[model samples]
Target chain A: MTQTAPRPTLEAVAERAGVSRATVSRVVNGAHGVREALAERVRRAVEELGYVPNQAARSLVTRRHQAVAVVAAEPETRVFADPYFAQQLRGISKELTAHDNQLVLLLTEGREDHARVGRYLAGGHVDGALVFSLHLDDPLPALVRGAGLPTVFGGRPGWDEGLDDVVYVDSDNRGGARSAVRHLAGLGRTRVAHITGPLDQTSAADRLAGFRDVRPDTDPGLVARGDFTSGGGERAMRELLDRCPGLDAVFAANDLTAAGALRVLRERGLRVPDDVAVVGFDDMLPVAEESDPPLTTVRQDIEGMGRLMARLLLRGLDGEAPEAADGAPVPAASGVILPTTLVRRATA
Target chain B: MTQTAPRPTLEAVAERAGVSRATVSRVVNGAHGVREALAERVRRAVEELGYVPNQAARSLVTRRHQAVAVVAAEPETRVFADPYFAQQLRGISKELTAHDNQLVLLLTEGREDHARVGRYLAGGHVDGALVFSLHLDDPLPALVRGAGLPTVFGGRPGWDEGLDDVVYVDSDNRGGARSAVRHLAGLGRTRVAHITGPLDQTSAADRLAGFRDVRPDTDPGLVARGDFTSGGGERAMRELLDRCPGLDAVFAANDLTAAGALRVLRERGLRVPDDVAVVGFDDMLPVAEESDPPLTTVRQDIEGMGRLMARLLLRGLDGEAPEAADGAPVPAASGVILPTTLVRRATA
Candidate 1:
């Protein structure tokens, strides 16, 4: 016990201001019917007494918690391993903090925790939710909808039914992938191959789609599957090399995969750009910049996307139309898709 | 907008249960005066109506929010760049979630946000707080104490005054550093050097102290300053090399620094272990295992420390003495310090 003084109560403030408790409550709650002179006296008394209102009591009257739940249906290990989640959380925290709202993080480990999350959301502990459910089979999006809370998804959700009414923020995955492959093509690489991330995730699936849009007629042997890990990238790169020995370029789903591919190419005594031009997505600084020859990859504004999601949800909560970063009104359902850029580096 | 049904109120449940609203409140709040028969009837009514108690209203009675605030006074960029914070958060989230408590993350950007954090803690929004203030000069601990909220620190706080009354959980940083240096010495590397992280952080200071414990009379020229980044490691390594070219071994403050040292050593045409054996603290998987020859380093149970911090706070909230991981009662003020291990790898 650090000898803390007892908190001042509404009654104490009312007494100091020479007003009824009801009048003080009305003034503090910002109720419009209160007279200005009485409210001014109450405010002065509150300042003098250093009175801080009880959040629970205030929330009861306003029906607002000044909090938003950030729900992510991913194992703790995965969420912590990747920097993508960290960047997005930073964006959400900044946006929410600016509005004086708290970020209540709800991380679910597996299917068993989904019910708990749903119940928490429906419990009205937060005004809205920002959900990140990357996998196509993830049940989180549906469960969140069942909670009937105002929510903005972190990425374009995989669900089909009722998706037209859902709001989301996503990087232009397909467009970014196209730009990467096009860069390789322009460099005169005819035997360009693709290494895909787990197809279960929408980002991975969309990147694979973009690869197809460019080399639709290419042999299927040029495509190898990876799980977006360095180890997975190594295995996929080996498989690609064994299947298509003449491949002159490789486009990996993300930077980690690209790093793995780079290591394998180095072990095989192949020179980057000279023998095999490699490009990756995400351009995650530590990975992309540290890879051998560095990585020429697609750079997505991950933090910007997170900020946009929070902004959209906050705007919707305020009964205003959702706006994109440029302040242009967007269709609520379509949400906003931030563009990505191709960052050229030594590898390509 | 999503056709959500209006929430069933306490009055509605009370009417259905054939009891007064006061009785329903007592029953739901687990107040002992309520008869079991009436409590059962109220419970049945609650279940049938799918009535989720309003958190705000319920909190007004119990004075418990079932939530804990995690305040980290680090800029978002720095916090995100390091995996340490993420791992700790995961551990805290797991322990808190298992207790049916929500995690309210409060990240401060700079000194400007201190007042806001202090006010929020004092606002009675959460039951307690878990603070991570690594720097010695950080004002968060004082602010948190001023708020008079029950708090547990994530790391060993650097403050001296009234520290005996504070509860915290931390890794054995000094012991870990000692092990890393001892291993290098056992390998017969006598001319060893050190690269230190920012001395402002207690962890960095403790590690530097540990290095001195093993080599108390070592020349000052063998030690160089680093900020726990690869670039910092590179610059520090260059300085150490310029100052003590005959040094046979180098101990880095962390894995990122070790990775940087390895790169610089390679560029300087020095063979790791053969020419200059290297050891790093924090066997951070991505950096340690991914380093050129893989880094041999000290491994601290970062996530375990987070879990212990939450456990200590939760136990304190329950009016019980804090206990260490081994189930022995610990002095409240001394708190708990988890042990670390030396992980053998190629670099050393």
Candidate 2:
């Protein structure tokens, strides 16, 4: 093997600066109670020696990697194609950069890749993890918990055991769906149909439940299932139209689905808000804005939720006490659910 | 600090398996010349102890971290919003997962973050890097080269010095453009206009060269500049119409631009293929297929390029000799340019 260039060590810096190892360590860690003169000497020595503090070496001594893992649990293409993950990732990037931490992205494809992720997390490569797009019955949540590392879920996780103990941030899915349906109802569209996302995930299920809360006796034919994709939405809308030709309104699970539904409505010679008023969830700016007729949708603070997830994990890493209620410290498992708002647009 | 659970060491595994320390080490590293019975014993002991090989420890011993940094050099929302990155990431993720390597995602927001990235790469946290979306004035390429870490550029990089030494993977932009113009000429469309992407990028520049290659003395008014976005495309298309209202055909630099131009044409009451024929680059499925009239486009193997980049970096890590021609070893800086094909669709 070729000989590699040697890096300067803390001991070398201490010797050059005429200080003890402890003093150099304190200066590097920015701990209080260090003499200003000694700290300056160490800093100057570090600059002269071009001594970059090796994260691996620091991790070995302090048991902190100064890095976080972001596991995007998207096994299929639909979730990855959604602008939701990109917006959330942008927010996470800003927060992580501010903290001087690294972001390790692990995109899990399916069950086969889960073991690899489990080993990586358990192997002490990162201090904490932020996971997203978890599906019901996924073994990843359990494996992540088993790793015994600080973790924050991006969405409302769907595991049976220790459900209340999982730290997560989520939008008010049920409430958003309720508001969307109510908007359609207020628009006086009585025969309202619904196009839900895949029923396997919690967000889709919650949205379906919210739709039922508004119209309990709706025709079974009026409800169709989509996969949170425009293609799937088009298919579902076509089925709904065939089953209930007189339906006057539709609530889609997301903006992409709404875009698809709009295409079908236009093809079928139906004018938006006149033939079928439409409302979508998660106002993904590009899709919602670009869709023909400009979809009326529920706008969740997706980026804000992403920022919150990172902040919560960092707080746990700092060992700060969790917020308390009634003089009792709340469990770290507690999460924050951000509110969602309905944005009125040309569609409704 | 709270006590962390002690991890089982090689010595402990050796003792449990009734093997020597060297034997256990060889088994863990997958070295050859180990007896089958002894290897099985060591494997069982490791399983019983739940030993996950410590990446940090292994990295220290082998000088290989098994982690590669993927720097998304886009601070703007456009790159993230584009499905291009998602496709590339999927390919990179699949390849890295297969190799049991981790991906460290470094998203640079602006100039300040560039310094942070330079420091991180120079800090020895990862083995190699894969950088994307390099702009004309980006100093990242030079910094990465100075850090002495192996790197692969996603697109044709925009560096001026040692241009032959910059390893990258790019599509045949000039060739693709030639084919697009040829198709228009074959249709006897004389007043062909061009919507060009930002000139700083080599892809956009090369596409313009190809357009000029076909129409050497085309009217100056036929060329308009766009920024590889739908909005930019709309503005550029309007400008092209203002300059040459009777233009019969257009070749957009990208699909998003084409989509934008199509919308403008619709608003202006021009018929597609009848009044104006359009062709776009980057056959992005959703955009190309979903446009009002399915777009004719130049299809580049984006995912394949991403996979090849990861493969090249991994090969460098493995110390494999580069391919040779005429009995001379090829230079490591050599790159591959994938081909592009024109797919005929509704508009053209």
Candidate 3:
């Protein structure tokens, strides 16, 4: 979700008019009880202007659109191929329905479409925005903030940079990876090679950091990088096998990579767990079931995360629009962090 | 996705102005070059309130909002359980991203929240809408149509009711199921059982009808039922097997159910493809691979269906709002059925 700046309201008009909000509301509502001269004056001015009474907006302000737009800053093919996108979406869809909010999925797959998305978010298109796979150079954050709409994101760059409190809901990659490595060490595996996801993502970087944090004595070259994909995993595994044939265990950053490593190992005539125990992260169900023997991996409750993201944004929407309250200071934007865990299965 | 109504635009206003469209545009946009006296008169009349036009919106009119909301008129739990959503989301996201359009997702699960959904759609928060699921009795189709936004449904309901031209994109369930049954009969399987999904959904009903259409000679009692879930399939299979102990083959509506039946047969100490050859539908990759021997099934690209829904809605946004064009006729809500095929594997 992007950080929404603030929605315009009658209260803002009241502040600008140097009058009580109730008085402005009364004028906007067209109540007849006001002083005749003032009522006539307000009516004439309001006629010279278009203003929808609160009746048109009150229910809309609180009612569930039951839909939230999923604005993606990634390409179409990449978005579909991403297993993470599917998992997160499944989780988000589950959570929203539970909350009685439906998901409106959208993507800005090309750079040309970026400006259009900024305008869309600002133009009252969605109740709130769930932004995904944003690049560092993306302008959506600034644009959404300028528009003052409620927003959330899968991952964000920083909090104190351009905006005050941008909400970012992300995986506990560091902790999950640390646990995976600890589990391997506990099982007495001395030579464990790691399959790392792409270095560009914080998720991939954090996982690699956590693995080394737990194994300070490990050889740096043992980390064979992959692109968090099955094909990447296969390529990385073959490289690792050639570089460190004595490696007794492997922990790929995600299930797809782990699955790829398993296929390669099977072709290389190695027995899982007996010859080279393997573990994967993001315990995608197939990763557990499809390995010659099922995989031992870290499991993240993706649906729960989606639900959390929705609730957090809903909580954000629960506040009143930033109205001038007798010239008081600005209110604080709340921030939250969720917990993660590891699930042990067959491969390890 | 449901087809939606047309939007209000500056051109519509200009056409309503009874003046040259450029004159109306100049008056609405507050061009300083206009004659002062004429500007005052035009401003007075325009402000007498056709609609509110902020500086940003003055260029467009009533305003585009530049966003679309998706309301899946189903429980969130159901949305998460199926893979169709992830696929559809991919498609919708791809197209919307191409246009830089914001997509909002919403689900209506609880009773209190369900009531709130309609107001949000009508409140002019979004320029258009997309609906993922529908019951014939659902008030959303009417509410969305009444709000005057374009809509598309992921699948069509059994009856269109008042929404005569509600645009919907769906897969050819009957055709797919017919092909599945024909494949089973062609294999020389004499006694076959069919597992069907929930009857409320047209897909489930049509698939069951397709199965019957192909094999009228099979016992009517062989039609067991599941809710597209593995657990449901297991229970349905228990009933079918007990009722028809002599059955030689089974066709489960989806892979999840087929997997469930496979488990039950294994538990009952029956051999697959020998005592009972089994087939399934929706060849989603994971479940198919994990079966004792991969299962043969009908394949539907749920993701592709989702993408098409996005495409249809995007097409509608191409030119003058459908209402103004005679050829398009707001594209009287139509239905689209995608193709499906049978994928052969070891189980069948």
Candidate 4:
């Protein structure tokens, strides 16, 4: 076995500096009230001996771990398959790194792991938490709140009960969806249809509401349900084609769904923007750009949302005011909702 | 502002149990020599008070943080764009969770972040590290070695200097590439072309060596360089086509590259598996399964590699022998190379 050299100790530094261990401790920890001459001697001795402070001992005195927990309640497959989580994580990681805080990821498989997460959070490991609770029925938010840890959510949490002070960062899903549908309708497509994502998620429900805002009295046959996946989109698209073959346009809930719809349209020998214009939400670069005709979609700053979540939580931890994107102070409970834009591409 | 009740402390538990603080600490720390009745009383007091151990305080005496650092030396875009990192993280997360250990993710953008990562590792914040150093000349390994942290590499590292006991977990990239080329050769493909990933990565270099092992006398024009991306694959495919128009088959370094190659082939009006057969590596489900005609590729146990890396590191930290996938004890420095298999699909 390869052996490493013994690390320099605080005692050695104190002895080398001709000072007591208590004096050296105060200087090493940056605690004031030490003589400048003695402090300088200790600093020089520390540098010469290459003494590194033990984080555990420092954290015990400071009551700060310098780490934050990033908890996501999603299956591994789903988390890896979608780009949304990746973008958000990148944003969170960057923000946390900038603040010199460590990101301790806690990925929960399901309800079974919720107790474990709650225990870990309450165990005083991390200074705070950045949680992603997408589904309305997910109990993670409630559990985290019970843990008494400062937390900022990744998206608009759907739970209504005990949500008074639950802060989160989310894209304007309804507004984005409205813009997509309005764009399609403005293109002289009177017979427009909508493909909805899983309604259990707040984002999906909001997108559906946005679609309804444009086509309030549309026929039930024009709306088909998708699970925000390519396969789901294909099935939904085929169902829409069967129920309303004369439909001139389709707005999917997300880019992955749109990619599936495009494949189905191509198989049915339909030309995009000619036979049937299509618009999708979430301009996920890989899916939106790589699609057959590319995809005209709503662009949300996914990474920004993540960064904001971290900022909000960190601010809360520091007892500072939370700020919006434009640097305006936001009430602690109100949270921030970022606007989305329509990205034009070949599809619509 | 909403305020949480103060947490119950060890002193509170001690008072409740009618014992000294030192007695409560001994029982809570599971120290031997405590009377069974006294320990039971202390445990009851802890449960009644809902007292949770302070990780920092406990870590001071135990010298164990119950945390591991996962360091990846890749830009956020690349790490998220590819599915490999996600899959590996999932595997590592599962194993760590089972062991009641936390995973601290440290993502480095480039050379600038190396010093910060080194300082963190040297600070003794984590028990060990799982490092992913892809490039041949990456200096991270040397820095980590200097920090004297037990580390397990995600992929086979390329550095040869001071590499006596460097442990790593890697898929048989060369063997997997050889199998892909041999499968193409078995189909009577005499002019088999190869598209390579960035040559700086050991995996890409090993795959290229495997291709040479099969087609020792192949024409130089049959090879093109790709950066393991769809765009890179498209350019490489077009170059291969221009250089050797008669090439019957192409083996791409990864699934994303193959997807790009497939798109270019379709645009040029070539029938898949008829006019030109294509094979890819790393059967990343999304890209491989969603490509034009799906993709015939080599499957590596990516998640398993992560799990093994964690297992190896944890065992080393515990002063136990490192075991291979089959549970056979191996020398620590020998490392473990997992086997890969070929998965057939529509394209080939």
- Highest-scoring model, DockQ: 3
lDDT of 4 by residue, B1-348 (tens): 999889999889978987656456556755433456777989999998899987865554246667788888886567666678988988887776666666667665566667667866766566778999899888887777655466788888897743434678999999999999999999988899999999999999999999999999989999999999999999999999888888899999999999999999998888999989999999997888888899999999998888888888777565565344455454344368899999999988
Docking class of 1: incorrect
CA lDDT, candidate 1, residue B264: 93
Error of 3 at B126 (Å): 3.5
lDDT of 2 by residue, A280-343 (tens): 9999988898889998999999887777777777666665642321232323445678889999
For all candidates in order, the CA lDDT equals: 0.82, 0.79, 0.68, 0.81
- Cα lDDT tens digits, model 2, B119-226, are 667566677788885578877776776554667889988876545545688889999999999999998899999999999888999999999999999999999999
lDDT of 4 by residue, A125-225 (tens): 66778899888888888788656566788878998753534678889999999999899988889999999999999999999999999889999999999
Candidate 1 C-alpha lDDT tens digits along B1-348: 589888999889988998766557656755433456777999999999998887966765457667788888887567656688888887787777777666667665566677677876766666778999988988888888766567889888998764655678888999999998899999999999999999999899999999999999899999999999999999999999988999999999999999999999999999998999999998887888888999899999888878888877777665565444455454444468889999999988
Runs in model 3 with CA error above 4 Å?
A1-72, A75-105, A108-112, A126-130, A134-152, A156-194, A211-219, A244-348, B1-67, B85-103, B108-112, B134-148, B163-165, B169-194, B208-219, B229-348
By DockQ, the better pick of 1 and 4 is: 1
Candidate 3 per-residue lDDT over residues A221-304, each given as its tens digit: 688999888899999999999999999999899998999999999999998888898889887776567766788888877755
- TM per candidate comes to 0.67, 0.67, 0.63, 0.65
lDDT of 1 by residue, A1-348 (tens): 698899999889989998766557656766433456777999999999999987866664347667788988886667666689988987887777777666767665566777767876766567778999988988888788766566789988997754545678999999999999999999999999999999999999999999989988879999999999999999999999999999999999999999999999999999998999999999897889888898999999988787788888777666555444455454444467889999999999
Best by lDDT, which number?
Answer: 1
Give one digit per residue, the lDDT tens place, for model 3 in B1-348.
Answer: 998555545455544543334344445643322345544655555654454444543433245566667777666556545566756776677555545466666554543454556666656666557786546556666555544456677887656443334568887889998998888788888888998888877788888989889887777789887988889999998998899988888988889889999998888888888888888888887888778779998898787676566656656554333222113222333577888988999887
Order of all candidates by lDDT, from best down to worst? 1, 4, 2, 3
Query: Residue B53 of model 1: what lDDT?
Result: 85
Stretches > 4 Å off in candidate 2: A1-66, A163-165, A173-200, A204-299, A320-333, A340-348, B1-63, B98-100, B123-125, B181-193, B214-222, B237-251, B258-279, B286-296, B321-333, B344-348
